[model samples]
Target chain A: MRGDLPAPSAAQIDIVEVGPRDGLQNESRVWPTEDKISLIGEAIAYGAKRIEVASFVNPRRVPQMADAEAVVAGCANAPGVTRIGLALNLRGAERALATGIEQVGAVAVASDAFGIRNQGQDRAESVGIAAGIVEMARRSGRSAQVTIAVAFGCPFEGAVDRALVIDIARALAAAQPVEIALADTIGIAGPGEVAALVAEVRTAVAPLPVRVHFHDTRNTANANIWAAVQAGASVADASLGGLGGCPFAAQAPGTAAGNIATEDMIYMLHRSGIGTGIDESRLYRAGRWLDRKLKGSSRSKVLVALPPGS
Target chain B: MRGDLPAPSAAQIDIVEVGPRDGLQNESRVWPTEDKISLIGEAIAYGAKRIEVASFVNPRRVPQMADAEAVVAGCANAPGVTRIGLALNLRGAERALATGIEQVGAVAVASDAFGIRNQGQDRAESVGIAAGIVEMARRSGRSAQVTIAVAFGCPFEGAVDRALVIDIARALAAAQPVEIALADTIGIAGPGEVAALVAEVRTAVAPLPVRVHFHDTRNTANANIWAAVQAGASVADASLGGLGGCPFAAQAPGTAAGNIATEDMIYMLHRSGIGTGIDESRLYRAGRWLDRKLKGSSRSKVLVALPPGS
Candidate 1:
């Protein structure tokens, strides 16, 4: 250790690998259902405990992930893995609950335009659905997490008021859900904003754990992860090969860019002496393999810059 | 601005534009030298007062910068643009100083193997060259700005101790340079580390304004930039199109993946209401056009996501 360098924090950082859900959802060349299962299995094998396995959405809309059932079933028996699913609507929630997945995710955007474009609903309607979904998850004896998308700034509405996000977060927290995640859906957050928002949410949620979901869309996810953690965010979300942008979320209407690369995030955390429990070598390989399959080169600098193994 | 938002800082954030030097250096296709001048013209027009125009390294070493002298000469007459040059050795510094550039950047690396592979010298030898270059710059009545590359972590040496980086920064600061930039040459810094190191360096060099140079290699550059600013980094180095990593700087060489995109940085800052004086529209245009010309694509989320004339 360097003289007077920062000592490692006593906090145990939890990295919720969103590659299976976020990464796969954004991939143009969809992997077969079995391959998706294998990917999640691989991640769990590499020390990822909490993984977003699949999203329960309209099959016609996202043809790539029509087999949400299979992905969930594939990971149900995986050792020490918490399989999660995304439920955008009541039908999605009902379907996800039917799978008996312990954790389900309900999502909404902070901006009206983004919420409309992303979920075909207004902010109030999305909140209503979040409340209903929380109730459903509870009735089913499962826990659901609410992720507020575009919590930082929105492309359509510009800068979103942090108060709006916090207000909605308070509402969702009142529902007493298991977790809440603040997302930079379009990658518009700065480190200061990340710190401030996480701190605010931590206070609002009190003892309830808060999470951060970031995109490398502007290539700042890793730093934001740290900022959120510093502000007491318990967990962070990342996509493999930095994948997972809402096809409807306009980063560039025609561009193919998305979330923060898992390998890059893992590298920063591991090198900083934070306990992420991830193997950098395996993570890099997964990113490379995923990108190659999609005919998209990874945008993660660490994954691309390092050799096959760190 | 939200009512809950805190009053913005009056900090005079400085942007050290490297499009002319770092951006043009690793371009895949030739830029006819004059094209670079046009680019520089656009940046200065967009209020970039501190522009690094060219490098005085051997033409054979970096063929893209073969016309360093002509490029500097052309940009030298631009109003309010402080043209600088990247100098590798005393010869480069002598040549750069002869051209009337205000600042000559001398680089040293923290890691031994990277220092040798990157600039053909070890840390001590590079320090010696840096000292000599500083002497030459001071003798010519110009300012010397030394950049310690691979300060965060080097590709060859792996994990770089913060102490080595601090020692190099202290030694360079002792030489009375106008500024010292800490380069995360391989882009592996976390937000916590970025903030901690910047805070530490602020103490290491009491009054000198510290700067940071980051690579978006792992999509953490923006986060690191935010952390740097919050931790007291006054200036940041950026390039358009997310271009400019030395072929030897990383384990996965020749990826052309380094530096946070200037447009991305400005977008994040502007969203946070920090004034960079850079027109986001112009920055995006330059990034897109540069990518088109180089047969390369930008890794900037803002550049890729935002509309033209935005």
Candidate 2:
């Protein structure tokens, strides 16, 4: 029985570096635009093919993203990298398009309560807006994608309906976005839920790739990501030093566990014989640099376990 | 494709609470024998069926386990709960058997380097000693189990060979222990590796169950545990508050990441529709109590994310 088991094939996994946008948005202190540019550059040098560099939201609402355009302009000279700008509305989409970023990411909420609280729209309305953003990006010859936030569970509504997520994915697929993503906004998903949902959504939107974003709030992010990949999700979103949280989401006091750390993710992937084109050493270095810039230790265990210069 | 995917059936998973033995052994400060008894009683209250209450090792080497007999005596009257004692060598095994504990856990090392360093025995010597301990337990009419430490990776030798692990498992199976466990002694393993190894080992040791033990050194413990279960591992070892580290293993400076927290493990297992016979609310309460006693916060993300009272 042991001899009959076949070895798992090594497959390339695409990692979307979201350290600059999703990572910094929740920090208490605002990072300088120059540091944001440097982080983006480090991500590119570490072989991140696609990076979410900035979010074109209202400056007053998200002060950390106020220098979005400056950060975009700073990375305009990078070669062989697709720069993605996240947009929550038409105005944000237009702003991202005007900046000539390579890709535009649209947001759709899976729960009505979170949808209304997060962006003043219901579930259907959020999906419609996200589809419209995809259409706008398509017309402008830019790649576009949609991420269904809180698709697994919602803080206000508890468990979101799985059928609702399928409907949202099918609706977003009509606009022909590059891919559809499921975001565990509050990080309350387990591996089984992730695998089942990713498989269902992958079938719901055939020919379109599936991406996954997870928070490490409950320490299930890495397991959820691994399950998604096993269930046919091709793209995964991660942050440097595991630095990310949703400022709009209701969180426990002093308990803001961020997104899965890129270094830790890469270490697991590479050790498991999966091919991720990112450099683990560079990720550790970038995490250390971010730690110095942020004036705090990184939450990444791999970064903390390995030596500073190793 | 998604429609054809079957819903995974819920299964009962056995959780072996090792808080008293593995959790406190690596702590610099020695906990009182009374506190150790309290911890054991709390584990029983939380529905832990089998608990490793103490290690019959040298007091000079591991001062935390100095009062192993006293601790065992404290929990001797607990009904329906199997109190396990970990023994490293013949002397330790004799001591554990004399204490009248319910189970004796013998540890064998997968790598020669770790075996020599951890127990002053090489690979063959460790296996012989563990097998001898199993015989001793059988003659003494007590249940025994064997754990192959560093089965995944070693701090000194690095990646351990899968074939060597299978051979060790098969050799240990000849001793007729209750079960065999694969321990990531240095906390270095990925989900993919865990799934493949567990499947192969389960086959190699047919009729005997496979248990898994992981440390959260690189933050992959939860993922690894999930994968092991998917691959047919029936039992898992976890510590309260994620408190464990090998005092003999080569570790990075100030980087002694412990085992997966029992609360986090229970949350993931229960959320994934698997039953562990453990109460989640009681786990959080016990974790809070442990935190107060240890004078530190728990490493469990769920414990940290949820409120203390909840």
Candidate with top lDDT is 2
Instruction: Point to the candidate with the largest DockQ.
Output: 2
Candidate 2 residues A277-306, lDDT tens each? 888777778888887886765778877667
List the TM-score for candidate 1's chain B.
Answer: 0.92
TM-score of 2: 0.96
Candidate 1 residue pairs in backbone clash: A251-B305, A252-B305, A301-B217, A305-B252, B215-B259
True contacts kept of each: 0.52, 0.55
TM-score per model (chain B): 0.92, 0.94
Candidate 2 deviates by what RMSD?
2.9
How far out, in Å, is residue B192 in model 1? Answer: 3.3
Best model number under TM-score = 2
